[model samples]
Target: MMLIDTSVLISMFRDQTGRVAERLSALVGDGDLYLTRFTQMELLQGCRDEAEWLRLDSYLEGQTYIEATDLTWAEAARIYFDLRRKGLRVRSVIDCYIAQLALENQMTLIHNDRDFEVIAKLRRYRQTTLDTVRSTDFHENDQDAIL
Candidate 1:
């Protein structure tokens, strides 16, 4: 399974080449998508207006949401301190939560944020950037056409 971060979701909502959106849709289509409660909160907070918030609420209404327990928060705190000691500062608590969720769940993370790169490198969790997913889609499409 893949845990999606809020950065990718926000980017997908903003950009319309349908790049990140398509990638997320592909994951959902393949039944490989999972979402954490932290991600839901972050995405909801990202909306600037009531209309956008309502839209997001409606969009997420039927989706599965994973809850982070006390264990997850404790682990995230450890990850935050560890990264801070390494001179890699994560800008938000939400980032740490997302990283910890991916680590504990053993799920590959799909994100467009650089913060996850540092966390992935340190924590040894699998991660893929938006560009990586896009290029992968391109390659897959090329192979399909050839076949």
Candidate 2:
């Protein structure tokens, strides 16, 4: 499984030719896309208006959602402190939680955030590269792209 991050979701929602959106299309075709509550909350928190909120909510409803266990929170705390001890501070505790969720589930994170790069270096979780789709010949009828 591949965990979807809020950064990727936001980019996908705003841009159709970006790395995150294109990667999402491919991953969805492979049946490897996934999402956690952490990402869902983060995405919902960024909605600018009711229309966007409903749109995001509807899109998320079609996704497979996962929950982080208590043990995952414990690991997240441990990771936060460990990074702090090494003089690395992630911008948000939610990022730590999401990273731990991906680690515990052994899923490759599909993200556009660089903070995950810091966490990945220490935690050793798998990640997939996202490259922008620069061509103009994108498939308009693709369900994944529409999502």
Candidate 3:
């Protein structure tokens, strides 16, 4: 399964004709796309008005959602401290929580942000960046590379 990060989702919502959106469209049909509660909150927070909020809220309802539990929170703290101790602190604590949530659920994170690069080094979760998707030739059988 794949966890669609806030960055990628924002791009998809803002630009339906963009590469990020195209990639998501190709992968979404597989029924493996997902979102974390943190991601949902981040997306909702981006809304400029009540109408945008309602539109986003309604769209998000179709996605598979995962909520963090106490265990998830505890582990996120550990990850935060560990990364800090290693001098690899992520830019956002919420990002740390999102990473932990994805790790706990064993989902590959799909994002357009570099913050996940640090988290990827410290965890076992997989991450597919927007650049990676764009560089990959999805036209041939190599489509599996993105899939």
Candidate 4:
């Protein structure tokens, strides 16, 4: 399973070379793709207007949705505390939640944000950046090496 993060979605919209589309296409039509509610909030918050929000919201409605429970929140806090103990800090609290949520659910997080890099280092959750995806032929079997 894979959790699609907001950064990658933005990359898909802003990149003109079609590399993002090519890589993401490799995962489409599979039943394994997913996104978190936190991601949905982040995406919706970035919309320019209600129309855009409605369009994006409708599109997101078709995705596999992952809901975070109270356990997810607790574990996210614990992960942040542990990272702080190690002198590492993820800039986004929501990124921390997303990472821990993915870990809790056994999902590999596909993201473009540097925040995930920081989160992954401290937690060992699977993740690959948009930069990595854009530069390679992404395959399910070779996921570990994609980033």
Model 4: per-residue Cα lDDT over 1-147, one tens digit each? 888987777667656787887787676546488888876777776777778778888888988888888798988888888888999967767788989888989888888777778887888887776676554332212212111
> Which sections of candidate 3 miss by over 4 Å?
27-29, 132-147
**lDDT, candidate 1, 23-118, per-residue tens:** 777755675677877666666765667787788888778677667878998888888889888888767767788888878888888887777777
Instruction: Pick the lDDT winner.
Output: 4
* Model 4 accuracy (lDDT, Cα): 0.74
lDDT of each: 0.70, 0.71, 0.71, 0.74
TM-score (C-alpha) between model 4 and the true structure: 0.82
Residue lDDT tens for model 3, 1-147: 888877776555555347767777676667587788776767776666778778878888888888888898888888888889899967777778888888888888787777788887887787777654443222111112111
CA lDDT, candidate 4, residue 70: 79
* Model 3: how far residue 122 lies from native, Å: 1.6
Q: List the residue pairs that clash in candidate 2.
A: none
> How should the candidates be ordered by lDDT, best one leading?
4, 3, 2, 1
Query: What lDDT tens digits, residue by residue, belong to model 2 across residues 1-147?
Result: 888776666556657556656667876577667788876776776666778778888888998987878798888888888999998877776778888888888888877666788887678888764535322222212233223
Model 3 pairs whose backbones collide: none
RMSD of 4: 7.5
Q: After superposing candidate 1 on the true structure, give the runs of residues whose Cα lies further than 4 Å from its correct spot.
A: 26-29, 132-147
RMSD to true structure for each model, in Å: 8.7, 6.7, 8.2, 7.5
lDDT of model 2, residue 53? 77
Model 3 scores a C-alpha lDDT of 0.71
Better of 1 and 4 by lDDT: 4
